[model samples]
Target chain A: DTAVSQTPKYLVTQMGNDKSIKCEQNLGHDTMYWYKQDSKKFLKIMFSYNNKELIINETVPNRFSPKSPDKAHLNLHINSLELGDSAVYFCASSPVTGGANTEAFFGQGTRLTVV
Target chain B: LAKTTQPISMDSYEGQEVNITCSHNNIATNDYITWYQQFPSQGPRFIIQGYKTKVTNEVASLFIPADRKSSTLSLPRVSLSDTAVYYCLVARSNDYKLSFGAGTTVTVRA
Candidate 1:
């Protein structure tokens, strides 16, 4: 079974369009995260949720928002997507050990292309 | 979060062992060093993690010196399938933010 899964393996949209990517984890982890990787293959953390509560919010643009309905799911929504938003988005989950984060399991990732 | 520095790239041959070193001079007392590997078109996968001394797992080994200023990840008998980008990160056990730097790309040739 896939521990962490994200929907829409590939997404192609035009500029100024808004879209959402869904993620789910069956690992029963308490923390979930969203990460972005650009053409240069630099991975950057965008947001993190611990047990459905926002914990980490990086300096991402306001156009991007992350919502966690529960500890098992975290979804990313991008508004007015721009060409620069073309990249791979990954979803990951990790368990909290004595208030600390442990190793994370990542999904296959969703490739988003904004034309 | 401690900043980690690793080689931008490395090359190896099949059956050869590869070692990539990472430097984190300002690592905190509560921080731990972790390494991840990423293949093409896939998310980064956790390989090994350690706080000090040496840690050996089936896929890789991590060595951290006493000063905790640097660490090394060793892959044994690498094959072409082992070629991937390896990332070294340092973060507190409680820290939820994981900052990834430009990883070392290991190219294994047959």
Candidate 2:
């Protein structure tokens, strides 16, 4: 069974449009995160959610929003997608712990292309 | 969280032992050193993790000295399939907020 899985493995849309990517984890992890890898191949954290609460919110644009209805799911929605928003978005999950040592399991990633 | 630094790239011949070193000068006392391997078009996969001294598993070996300021990931008899980007991450805490560094890209020649 896949530990972490994501939907819309490939996405192509026009600028100013809206899109969403879904992620799910069967590992029973309470923490989930979203990361974006740019054309330069630099990966940066966008958001993190634990137990349905927001934890880490980087300096991302306000147009990007992450929603987690439950511990096993975390989804990302982008509004008014811009051309610069084109990149590969990855979803990952890790077990919840008091401190930080848990290793995260990542999904296959969603390639978003904004025209 | 401790930031790690590694070489941008390395080249190795097939069947040779490859060792990639990562330096994390500000590693915290509770931080654990972890290594991950990522092939192009795929997410990273965990390789080995260690607290200190040496830790070996079926895939790779992690070597950390007493100071814990640096660590080395040794891959024995590397093959073409082993060519990928190797990332070194310092587990910030048990909560699992992992921060990834640029990582070292290893290219194995036939």
| Best candidate according to lDDT | 1
Q: Please report, in order, the local distance difference test score of every candidate based on alpha carbons.
A: 0.92, 0.89
- Give the residue spans of candidate 1 off by over 4 A: A97-101
- Judge the docking of candidate 2 as incorrect, acceptable, medium or high: medium
Computed on C-alpha atoms, the DockQ of candidate 2 is 0.50
- Give the Å shift of residue A24 in candidate 2: 0.4
- Tens-digit lDDT string for candidate 1 (A4-68): 99999999999999999999999999889999999999999999899999988999999999999
Q: What is the lDDT of residue B76 in candidate 1?
A: 96
RMSD of 2: 1.5
| Per-residue C-alpha lDDT of model 2 across residues B1-110, encoded as one tens digit per residue | 88899999999999999999999999888888888898888887878888999999998999999999999999999999999999998875654467778989999999
Share of native C-alpha contacts between chains A and B (below 8 angstroms) recovered by candidate 1: 0.51
lDDT of 1 at A54: 91
Candidate 2 residue pairs that clash:
A99-B93, A99-B94, A99-B95, A100-B93, A100-B94, A100-B95, A101-B93, A101-B94
- Cα deviation at A115, candidate 1, in Å, is 0.6
Candidate 1 lDDT for residue A26: 99
